[model samples]
Target: MWLKKIGGLVAILSLSFSGMAIAETTKDNFYLQVGSNRNGDPIVLDLASVKGTEYTLLEQHGNGIERRTLRAACIQGRLFSRRLAVYESNGHLTRVDKTEQEIFPKPRSADANSMEIVCRVAANRTK
Candidate 1:
């Protein structure tokens, strides 16, 4: 059942991105939309900043934005935020966190989608 749900979500994401061009939708060419979360907030991955198993993810949250450095454990199929920066709506940096919290993304959540995308890319990079 869990596999089925993840597959269904992947299908939905594929369809959603099929009609849109990444360059036209994102603010810049370096950021690609991974997918939106349950709340419909856009989640984007910074393509140029990806290094090995780490990726930079930018997410829209309410009236603010968050930039996170996520380390994808491709083998374990999980990821954790190594660093985070919260920004105001005007693009002002409000807070920066350098904590090494290892919170796994919940199933079927936006973070799950991000983990799935990042892990897939990271896995492919090794091959």
Candidate 2:
């Protein structure tokens, strides 16, 4: 009876550990995929590690920008800033933004914490 109990405990532990896995996002950087299927079914992939600023395209849709590097702390396809849409590796609009880039001359030197982007309003319509 004791032998049987020990075996059962081992089996239970093994099964529990099998499903115990850390999410793709780690202590540093990562990736994710959020979009729809061919039939317009929503899907998501919390990816593994992502190294640099340049994103890696994982999958592409027929219309929207290709999903790429996982934005840490993003939810429901939006970033922490709650940006309306995402973009492609090649820098295509995620939806339709009517924003413009700030055209300020670069300072003598750059600060690690300061970054800038040029935003443009979306022209395409998808509802």
Candidate 3:
């Protein structure tokens, strides 16, 4: 009977250690939907594809009809901004570039928009 109890305790310990390992390997994703732009077009941002210190930022508009992807690396780099700004023209994604600091001067505030939030979260995760 004591042998059975020992085996059970060993199993429980192994399971708990495995759970911690899984949690360490797992990556988190952040999703947010900001309000519409000047043309009343909705915008959405998803940061799900995280690998190490890098992640992919997926931006969608007009209910996913318009999509833009930005490969963001949160590691130490020369880039001033980690998040890429998606420029839309006439309800279409036209260009993507590193976001300007001036655009999100108060990024840490609770009222920050989706882009600022994603940028901050991604950078923090890298650290």
Candidate 4:
């Protein structure tokens, strides 16, 4: 009887650890698919992470993901973006970069689509 109880406890512990491992590999559901980029990869925006004029965008790369933090200039329709970090498909941080770039979206481009959605959301919040 005691041996059975010990086996049951060990089983429970293993299940709990497996759950934690799964959680680490999955992303939260708050990121919404805004549009697709030039390469047809899905571009997602973390609406819940928006702060003031800055928002987080996640782009699907080969087997990993690249996350960028961008500040919007709504009136001028521009985005100031910085490469924040990259994560593996298993949701592990690979590296972090702070290289900044200024974007002026050309007509009918992926960046233009993203800028429109982001600015609209930001504009609505101020009212």
Output the TM-score of candidate 4.
Answer: 0.65
Q: Residue 71 in candidate 4 has what lDDT?
A: 82
Highest-scoring model, TM-score: 1
lDDT of 2 by residue, 59-105 (tens): 33443443333222211212211123455444576564334232232
- Model 1 stretches astray by more than 4 angstroms: 1-28
- Order of candidate numbers by lDDT, starting with the best: 1, 4, 3, 2
Ranking by TM-score: 1, 4, 3, 2
Model 1: how far residue 112 lies from native, Å: 2.3
Please report the candidate that would top lDDT against the real structure.
Answer: 1
Residue pairs with backbone atoms closer than 3 Å in model 2 (clashes): 31-70, 32-70, 96-122, 97-121, 97-122, 98-121, 99-119, 99-121, 101-118
Model 2 segments more than 4 A misplaced: 1-29, 32-36, 39-42, 45-59, 63-82, 86-89, 94-127
lDDT per residue for candidate 4 within 55-87, as digits (tens), equals 887777667777888888889867887668877
* Candidate 2 vs. true structure, TM-score: 0.21
| Residue pairs with backbone atoms closer than 3 Å in model 4 (clashes) | none
2 or 3, greater by lDDT:
3
Q: Each prediction's TM-score against the native?
A: 0.66, 0.21, 0.32, 0.65
